[model samples]
Target: MKNLLYLVLFLLAFSACNRKASDASYSWASDLHQRLLTDFCLTEAQVKDYIRRYLPDVTDEQMRQWEESGALECMMLDGEKRYFRNAGPNLFRIDSLCREVKLAKEGEQVSTSDRANAENLPEILAATDGRGDSCLAAPKRMRVTYTLTVDTNAVPAGEVVRCWLPYPRTDIPRQQDVKLIATSEPSYTLTSEGTTHSTLYMEKRAVSGEPTVFSETFEYTSYGEWHDIRPSDVLPYDTTTELYRRYTSERDRHIVFSPRLRQLADNLTEGEDNPYLKACRIFRWVNDHFPWASAREYSTIDNIPEYVLDNRHGDCGQVTLLFVTLCRIAGIPAHFQSGFMMQPRAWNLHDWAEVYFEGIGWVPVDQSFGLAPYAEKAGKPYFYLGGIDSWRMVVNQDYGMPLVPEKKYPRSETVDFQRGEVEWTGGNLYFTEWGYHMDIEYLNY
Candidate 1:
């Protein structure tokens, strides 16, 4: 009996240790800090091979030089040197020589659809000219089928898999006439109106060898907006108002006005007084400084604006956050806005900013698109500053907002909601365990 008692204690202690070990393993995968390093999975050889695609004659010395200059982003993870997943492509975007070689190889061949989209910007600007109240123009009807599929055996068979897909927000003026045509599931929960990260929640039971799929078909009319403002006519913000207080104040992590950021803002707007002009200065600075590059997962990033500042290059969302942060620092009310830039055949996930002009209300600003080269040549250098193209699907009004019904686990994308998210009763399904695809059809207006 005494031996039995000892055996019971031994078993209890062993089980406890195993549980602790399992928890630690799960924490390493799910913990935000540890997950940050997961995206930096490339090796030195892989980076070199990728770079050679752009510059076949590139040498080891040149690679070393670029790495030393921080053009090739890398980190030491778990005692192994790893390069950022996008580091190779980012090299071409950041390094002058690499860019020259890349451009030379690509030449000046713009697709018909791309050229049309580019030309459409000035047309939108021209159409909206002199019509202050008619900011919305060139509306396009679109039907989108967004699908999220969990890998076979991702969850135990017969267990229910919960998924939250991004549904367009109807509160925006430009995006209107949103209609849900159908969903894969018969019954689903569409979040209450004004949920920051608007979502359509659905669930499905997993099969032993079949993937669990959640999909929705929705249609909406998106309008392009252009704000023509004369600096002299711009009015001062009512600092006492909620709009001013909320947008101008810093948000945690991403939007904080660190000393470096403050100094940079001060330098950029050294002599500028008007809020509109100040925002323009900040916008142009970010556009000029940070060229677009593929980005790591937003969830892993703690402070996006700071990351851009440190790296000197970022993707659409990254640069937008930087611009928004700078605008806030300069006392211009700015906030983050993002969704798919549904530009016909060229649609993809895109992010931009919206600045609150006291008299004009909130106008769209896309620093990623920056000043269109053609627009700049046409004397409308600030086209994207106070204007936006119509092919947009606004999903989230603000970043990092909670989803409806609330997700039980950490979000697959904690910052942005365009890709959609998934989980089960067991835990959150990371991007690896699941995949998402968006199919868009542009319908005639």
Candidate 2:
């Protein structure tokens, strides 16, 4: 009887373990949710009050229903109620909740673009040269500088502050003539460590009460490139090769495949055979489908691709990641390349993917830009698939890879690396604690 009981208990435990593995529910989700309730709780009244104060149209009845259903939870950070753009996770039918509450409350669709498309876009298209096989355009080269600064008063006094500022990638072909002109603190600067993402490291000790600043001034010539690719010319890469196998496989947390995703891919590419054609189909579907919305921090979301599909709206990183995942699912190689994008008189951090065509090499694909109202013209629609504007400042070749020195605390942005990361002996500094600035001057060589 004792032996039989032991076998039963062991079998039950094994089944539970298998169940978790089968579903691919992140182990961290439950714990993070619990923290939301226990450590980060805001009382029901507090939530209602906040809504009344900021969102006057939201009703007591509607708010009450959402709370009772566990679809809404107020996030508290540093003893203050912090607002995240979306409800972290819906305990019920999240997709439905988003459509009714989030979208309905807004009264219109999400913002696709706040500005016109690049003014020089016509020139880019005009510059394209069909060199026998593919279209190639050379973006005018310019020297540019980037700077990132942090406030000393934000962090506690007497602790040492270390920062990792993103440096322009030298490995890629487009940018060249790299130069490091200066740093705020000259004595403690480090550069060019061998890592997938390049960084210019700098550090300074907090002086009783003073701001800490870090900056890197560099010049690199920029070029725009596109290869006119045909499906027949894109020969299949050797999938058995280790590099192909690694990139083609699922990545942790953000890039997993599920039944829903597979079904969506299958539905989109029902009759498509060529990988490039399949990619084009998925790209068009995503661009037409999703709109841009303020997103919850990447740390709070699990599967970005699935999240985009569920919400029907996502920011640049979210949409680009979705495109990349779908392409990989179709057996085409794709990865992330992102940093800052510069337009005349404007600059903002951005994310986009690069797809590998056997004959054409890796090509840029910005579904967010391609889908925007501005790029909806002849030839411009397909420009991002292979041709990216020279305005792009490519910093990362891939996402979720570690920094050269490694981070002591969980990163400020867990999914993508940008801006920079900072920390001291006490703990990791949040984005609320510091700010960064970049000054770009167009230089003629």
Candidate 3:
């Protein structure tokens, strides 16, 4: 009887262990749920108050109507309703009525520097007019200090905290003259040039009541590139080449081609046989169809492009991915490129795409910038289609790439790597537990 009882208890224990193993595989799902809640933390009352700033006469019924029409996004959590963190500001950008009201209240104002920047594209096109395959010009040099700080008590005192901050890539043509000036820590490990997501790794022991900070100062030169691509001049891609096969092929997660994606690709590139023209059609479609809006955390999103298609809106990275996926589906070789857009006085994290033309090689395409209104008026409607400005810092040549000194815990940001990552013996420190800041100083032009 005793032997039989022991066998039964052992079997039950084995089953419990197996269940835990199965649950461990889906740990990300649990983490994602928490992230979603953080993103959608705004309460319904808070959102209403926010909208009232622009639409002073907004009524409860109207708010309901907007929510029902999907003009405003919300989710039910913890048995109570919650709205997206940016739902209020995004309302002015997304909804037609709100946009008009906001525009009326605050007239459309473009800064003088921004206007001049827009006007510079034509100059670049003219300067690089006869230079075949030599698109780089107008180099701007700048120094940048990037810092990441983990809140006090994020991890227990005396525990070691590891950090990975964005470092400029030395291999790119447009970005050059890379030099690391200094770092907060005396000892640091800078990843090799080959790392897809270039990073500078450092560590410090957490203090009892103080934030753990990591920083680096560096300088690099960025050049404006304008590819005078003539659709007729583009040669047929050597489909058998490794470059053609690799970029044109489907990637996992964000770049997958689903049934709807395939149909959308065909519809966008319906009659185009030329790869450049096909890419143009797809790019125009995404820019026209999906307007930019504030986005949720990327780590919570499983498939980015599909989310954009469903929501009818996306931020910079989201729209770029949609454009990339569509281009790949249309048999064009496209890849992801991202970093910071370092336009003076207006620097922020940004993402864009790169497409390969058979003989022309790869050219930059910023879907978010799209066709600037001024550029359109200047007869340079597709300026961003094959041109980029000098105000950029290319840190990551590709997205979702691994960091050096491999992280033991899952990254706070799994998709993008602009903001540095932090982890300790306890676990990963998410955006809520830490913060990042970047300061740019223009060295020369």
Q: For each candidate, what TM-score against the reference?
A: 0.91, 0.76, 0.91
What are the runs in model 3 whose C-alpha is more than 4 Å off? Answer: 1-26, 111-113, 119-123
Better of 2 and 3 by TM-score: 3
Best by lDDT: 3
lDDT of 1: 0.84
What ranking emerges by TM-score with the best candidate at the front?
3, 1, 2
TM-score of 3: 0.91
* Candidate 2 segments whose C-alpha is farther than 4 A from its true place: 1-116, 130-145, 187-194
Whole-model lDDT values for every prediction: 0.84, 0.69, 0.86
Ranking by lDDT: 3, 1, 2
| Model 3 poorest 10 in a row by lDDT | 19-28
Clashes of each: 1, 3, 0
lDDT of 3 by residue, 3-71 (tens): 999999999999678756654654776777888899999988899899888877888898888787566
Better of 1 and 2 by lDDT: 1
lDDT of 2 by residue, 1-445 (tens): 9999999999999967875664464334553454344434445555555555335566768765665443553455656664333443332223354455545555655332224244455555677652443344445454555555557576667667889888877877776666777767776444453366778877877765677777777777666666556789677788887767777778887778788887887888888778778888988998777765556667767799987876666788999989888877777889878887765566788899888877667777888776544455535567677777767677888888877677766677778878888987555666667788777777741
